[model samples]
Target: MLLDFGCGPGRVAGHAGRALGMRIIGVDASPDMLALAREEGTPGAEYHLVADGRVGGLADACADAAMCNHVLASLPDERTVLEVFTEIHRLLRPGAPFALLTTDPACAGIEYASLRVGEPGVSYGPGEAMPVRLRRTDGTWQSVRNHAWPVETFPPLLEGVGFTDVAQHHPTPDEAVGVADPEHVRSRDWSAERLRPPLVVTTAVKR
Candidate 1:
């Protein structure tokens, strides 16, 4: 079985299920996202709420693999990452794969990297929330807050949680990939910088 851990809205889970034809399960912390998953997910997909970033609810060695995409960067705390790793290790059989895709803020644009955390807001999950002022080239400001992690620390943390054989995929500089349509091109143009290199993809074995 494949556990799509931190599957938001089940979009990727559905696609991955179709592509791999594997028994799939999904987990998420957001009720709204999970509700959408229930409404739109593939017929056989199973889903459950993570509640507190703990996965004790799942049976041991119940999954063959776990995939966490685009959700690591938003986890509420560092311990939550550890918890997820522990949970994944527990849920998967020996030598099962745990894959993750996460944002590396160090690859952020100069403007984005320069922004300061303005008196960070309430703590959530594994970390605190901080307001960021996006510095626009036109001298205008845009405000948003995102969960941040220091890129240099992830490997050790993953290792600490009983993951081994960890491998990271780094961004390739300007690799040409086809855009199927105009909308796709537009979306790429808008998000490319933020989505490019420094977005780390990692895979580890539960050993």
Candidate 2:
């Protein structure tokens, strides 16, 4: 089975279970998000609540693989981020792959089609507070306060928690050609995206 660590609203869990044909165990701390996930139930997927930083009734090394999507930026500090990573580490067996998706902390000021991080020409320190703006489909923008965790910090944290071969990559717009919507890729002028990619994918193996 695969674990969708911090699977808010089941977007990643449901899509992953459907696209990859894997049995998913989605765990989250929010009751409201869990309720939404249950409402939009994915086939061959189960939802659970994370209480006191632990997913209840789950055994260690039960998941073959896991993924966390953009969950770290919401955390207050590196210690809390490590705590979450450690929990995810416990769920996977030896050599299991953990793919983490996050916003690149350095990709601030640039306005992408969907989101913008921090203010223009401003840089944030590790675990520093910043304002993030996300563009909705209706052309509306939503502002949220988020913590910035630089890309460099993840490898050490992941390694400290028994994860090896940790690697981080900033994905450019060109890389999304095949997987993402063709129309979306074709329609937008992605100069800023090509120049400063906003998304980072960190991969590691449980050791």
Error of 2 at 3 (Å): 0.9
Candidate 1 lDDT tens digits, 1-207 = 899988889988887788787878899888899899988848798888886666546788999988988676566677777888877788889899988876555543323332433333332333445444655656577877767665555678878878899888764324424412344334333343444454567889988
Best by lDDT: 2
Per-residue C-alpha lDDT of model 2 across residues 13-83, encoded as one tens digit per residue = 88778777799999998999999988887887888898877888999999999999988888988778988
**Candidate whose TM-score is highest:** 2
Candidate 2: where is the Cα deviation over 4 Å? none
Candidate RMSDs in Å, in order, are 5.8, 1.2
